[model samples]
Target: MRKVSRDRGYHHGDLRASLITASFELLAEVGLRRFSVAAVARRLGVSSAAPYRHFPGRDHLLSAVSAAAAHDLRSAIVAAADRAGADPSSRLASVAEAYFRYVVRTGAGFHVIYAAELYAVPDEARREQTRALMATLLELASAVGVPSHRQAVALVEAIVAVAHGYTTLFAEGFFAQGALTVDATAARAVAAAEALIRAAGDR
Candidate 1:
C-alpha cells in the first residue's frame, strides 16, 4: 500500500476512496472511541472540514470503514475455506479460523464492525456486504448438510458467536498474555466451529 503524502490536498485524486482507506488505518491505529472525521482528514493531508463533503459525519465515515472490514473478512473466509480441503465441515470451520485471525490482526476494525452497533442499522452498501457474507456462509453450511434455511442461519450465527467468544478471550489477553498464541487460539476456534457444525448434523 502506497503511503499517501500527507502534504497533498484533498482534490489531488480520489478523495472519497482515499478517506475510506485512511479511515480504516486510523481505526486500526487509534480505536472507535477516539476516531473522528478530523483525525482521518489529518492523516490524508486534507482540511478537517474537507472530509465532510464526502462523509456527512463521523458515523457515516465509520460505516465506510466497517464496510471495508466486511470486504476483507469475506475474502479471507472464502480463501481459507478453499484451502481446507474437500471436507465440508472442515471448510466451514476454517471460516471461523479466518475470523479469529482477522480479529487478532485488526482488533480495532473488528470492534468497530461488531461491538460498535454497526449491524443494528447498517447502511445499504454495508447491508449488501453483510448479505454477501451470509450467502457465503449459507453455501458452506449447505455443504455441511444443513437442510433448511432456518437451520443454516442458526448454524452460521452459532459459529460466529463461538468464534467471538474465543477471540475476545485471547485477543484481549484474558488468558495470560503468553498462554495462547494467535494461531493456537484460532485453532481452538476452528475446533469449536467444527464441533458446532457436527452437532448440527446430529440434531
Candidate 2:
C-alpha cells in the first residue's frame, strides 16, 4: 500500500494530482528542508516548469501536501479510537498509538502536516482539520476526568507530545539500535499515554 502510493507513475489524467503524489515521494526521500518543485516535476517526467502551472511556488505546493496529510491523519486517529470501543482510556491510548504508527509508517508525514514554517501564519483549511483532530483528543481526555478544564488540555498535549517524541526517536534510529519493532514502539506509546491520562485524574 505504501509502495503503491509512493511509486505511482503519472501516465495521464490530472497533472496537478500527479505532482502532489510525486511530492510525497520527494518529501520522504529528501525531507522538507530540501524538497523542490523541480524535483517533483522530474519524478513525474514533466518539465521543471510544469508544477508552477498548478502551484505558484514551493510553499503553495507544500501547503497542499500538508492539507492532504492533515485529512489523512484525522481519519487515522478517528478510526483507531473508534475501534478501541467504549473505553475512554483505551480510545485515548489508541489515538496515541495510531499517531505514532502513522509517523513511522509514512515518511515525512508528521513533519509535513505540522511544519513549523508553514504554521506561522496557517491556512484556514489546514487549521480546521488540525483543530478537529485535536478536539477528539480533548474530548477523550475530558472523559478520563481532569481536576480542571485547563488540565484536560494539558492531558491531550502530553499524549501528543509523547507520541510525537517516540516517533521522532524511532525515526532517528534510536529504536533500531536495539531489538525494537514498530508494533512494539506503538504499544510503548500507548502505555506511556495511558499512564499520563491516569495520572492526570489523580491530580
Candidate 3:
C-alpha cells in the first residue's frame, strides 16, 4: 500500500538501473518478504507501474538482483584466484577465503541470492548465472589437481558449503563467546578447508 510518485523524469537517466539500486537497498534493509514493487517505486520516486516497464514484476526484480549478486561473487572469486598467484593450491585456499569474506561482507546480498525463498522456482537464466559462478571455483579446484572434473566440482562444493555454514554460524555470534577474533576464526576455517581439499586430492 505504499504511495508511488507521479513524477515524469524517471524515464531519463537510467531509470531501470535506479530502480534496481533502490530495490537492492530496500532488500538489504527489510529483506525479501517486506520488499514490494510499490515500496521500490516509492523509494525511487516513480509510479508503481513504472518499474513494470523494465521488470515484469517483483519476481523479475528479485531475479535481476540475484543475477547481479551472482556476477559480483564470480568476479570476487576470480580476483581472489588471481591474487593467490599461479599456484593451484594457493588459489584454492584463496578462493575459499574470498568466498567466506564475500558472504560475510555482503551478507544481505548473499542472503538474497542464496537463501531467499522467492527464487525457489528454477529460472534457467538465474541457474545459468549461478552455474558460471560455481564453475570458477571448480576450475580453480581442477587447477589445483583435484584428480578429475567431477572430483573438482565436488571439492569446490564441499569447501563452499563448509565456508558458508561457518560464516552463517559466525554471523550468529557462535564464536563471539570464545577468545578468538573473527579474522582468526576465518583464518582457521580457511586453513582447515585447505587441509581438507589437499587430503581429498591425495585420495
Candidate 4:
C-alpha cells in the first residue's frame, strides 16, 4: 500500500527558494528580531519543521538571504561601472549613483546585506564580497592618480559614506525638507563622489 504524505506544499522541489522569499516578506513586515523559520514555513503552507530540511536554523537562513542580497548589489555596481565607460572619474560617479539608486530600489534588502549585527551571523564573506565590488572604484581612483592605497581607499570610503548617508536620510524622510527627488538625490551623490576623487588628487 502507498502511504500518503503530510508535508503540505513541501513537495515542491523549490520549497527552499519559496521559504527564502517568504522570509524576506516576513522580514519586511516584522523585522529580524521577530523573524523565525516557523513563520517562513507557515508562509509556505508547510510543516514548521520543513525549513530545517533546507536551513539548519534561522541564522543560516539569514546568511543565505544576506549573501543573495550582496550578489544583487554587486550586479548593480558592475552594470553602473560598465555603463560609465573607461573613464575612472566617470566610473566612480556612476558607481556611486548606482549604489544610491540600488538602495532606493531595494530598501530593506540593502540593510539586511550590510547591517551585520542584526543577523548574528559571520559577515566576513559578505565583507569580502563588498570589498571586491569596491575594488573597481578603488582601481579607478588609483588610475586617476590617488597616489597611494590608503588615499584610494579613503576616497572610496568617502563616496560610499555619501551614498549610505543619503540612503538613510532619504528613508527617514529627511529629504522631505527639501522635497528632493530620487534622481536629484542620486545626482548629488554622484557629484559628491566626483568631488572626493578630485579632492584626493589635490592632496
Candidate 5:
C-alpha cells in the first residue's frame, strides 16, 4: 500500500481552503450533526488523519468554516449598504435584502454558524468575527439615523431576527403553500423592517 501523506504534496498552501470547501459540502449533504474532520478529509480524497494536521478536531474545522461564512456575509452587507447610497430607507432595505439573499444562498452553512448546538464552543476568533459583522450592520443602522448608538444596535438585532426567521421558514417551504414567492416574501419583510426603522426614528 502507498503511504498516505497528510500534506498531500510538499506545500499545503491550499489545505485550509480545501478543507473548508469539503466541510461545506459535507454540511449540505449530512448537516452539522454528522459533520466530522474524518468526513471532510474523505470528501477531499485525503488521508483520514490529514485534517487533524491542520484542524485540532471537528469543532475547530466548524469554527473556521463558520468564520469564513460570516466574513462573506459581512462583506455582502457592506456592499449592499454601499449600493443603497445615502438614502436611509434605501440603505435599511438593502441591508435586509442582502441578509435574506445571503441566507437563501448559504442556507446550510448559515445554519451551522447560527445554530447554537452546532457551535456551542465556537473559537474565540470566530466569535469576535461574528460580533464584528453584527457591529457592521449596527453601524449601518446608525448611519440611517436610528437615534442613539444603543438603539441602532437593538434595531439591527431585531431586523436580523426577522430576516433570519423568515429565511428559515421560507427554506422549509412554509410560504410556498401560501402563494408567496421568495422574492415577494423578502420584499414584504424588508418593507416591514423599514417601517420599524421609521417608527424607531419617530420615537
Candidate 6:
C-alpha cells in the first residue's frame, strides 16, 4: 500500500485507522523496546509529527493497539469455543489451541496486549475484553461439572496460565529443538487445559 507522505496533508479519510495499522506492523517488526511514534510515522510514510496529530503520545497509541489486540484475542477464543461442539472439554481444548495459534501469528504484539503496564485495567474496553475471555472459560468449566463457581474460576485460571506459558515459551523458541508441528504443539496446550478442567471436576 502506498503510504501517505508528510507533505500529503492528510488527504486520507481515516488517519487514525492508518496510524493503528502502521503501528501494528512496526511493533511486530521491531517489538516494544524499539517502538516509537517516529517508527510508526515512517511506516505510514508521514512526518514524525503526523502520529501526534491523532495519538497525543506513544502511550495513547500503544493503548489503542493493545486494546485492539485484546479484543481480537477474545474473539478468537470465543469463536473457537463455539465451534468445538457442546462438550466442555472440547471447548476448552479448542480455545487453548486457538490461543497458541494466535501467539504464533502475532508474537511480540500479543505479549504487548497482555502486558499489564501497557493494557491498564482502567481502560474499560480492554477490561471488558478480558472479562469476556474469562467468562468463556468459566462457562466451559461449569459445563464440565466443575461443582462450584470458585472451583470453576480456579480451573479457568489454571487453563489460561498453562496456555499462556506454553505460548510464551513456544514463541521464544524454547521448544525450537523439538520437531513439533503446530497441531502437535496446540494439542499439548489443549491437553493441559482439559486435564486441569477434569481434575477440577474430580476434586
TM of each candidate vs. truth:
0.82, 0.86, 0.74, 0.75, 0.78, 0.80
User: Worst 10-residue stretch by lDDT in candidate 1?
Assistant: 1-10
Ranking by TM-score: 2, 1, 6, 5, 4, 3
- What is the C-alpha lDDT profile of model 3 across 1-203, one tens digit per residue? 11124342454758877776676667645666788889988887778888899887777777776777787778887888798788888788876677677666555334567655545655777778777887787788888776688898788877887777777777677888886666786787678778977798779
Q: What residue runs in model 1 are displaced by over 4 Å at the alpha carbon?
A: 1-11, 108-111, 114-123
Residue lDDT tens for model 6, 1-203: 12445453454668787777676666655667788888888776778997888887887887777777777777788788888988877887676788787766654334577665654435676667656766766787788876689987777777777877887777667878996777888889998888776677667
**Candidate 6 segments exceeding 4 Å error:** 1-11, 108-111, 118-122
Deviation from native of the Cα of residue 69 in model 3, angstroms: 1.3
| Runs with alpha carbons beyond 4 Å of true place in candidate 3 | 1-11, 26-49, 108-128, 179-182
**Which is superior by TM-score, 1 or 3?**
1
* Candidate 2 structure quality by residue, lDDT tens digits, 167-202: 888878898878689899999999999899778767
lDDT at residue 80 of model 3 (Cα atoms):
82
Question: Which runs of model 4 end up more than 4 angstroms from their true locations?
Answer: 1-11, 22-48, 108-111, 117-131
User: Candidate 5: TM-score?
Assistant: 0.78
Order the numbered candidates by lDDT, best leading: 1, 2, 5, 3, 6, 4
Window of ten residues with lowest summed lDDT in model 3:
1-10
Q: Worst 10-residue stretch by lDDT in candidate 5?
A: 1-10
**Which window of 10 residues has the lowest lDDT sum in candidate 6?**
1-10
Name the candidate, 2 or 4, with the larger lDDT value: 2
**Clash-forming residue pairs, model 1:** none
lDDT of 2 at 102: 72
- Stretches off by above 4 angstroms in model 2 are 1-8, 108-110, 120-122
Candidate 2 vs 4: which has more TM-score: 2
Off by over 4 Å in 5: 1-13, 28-30, 108-111, 114-128, 178-181
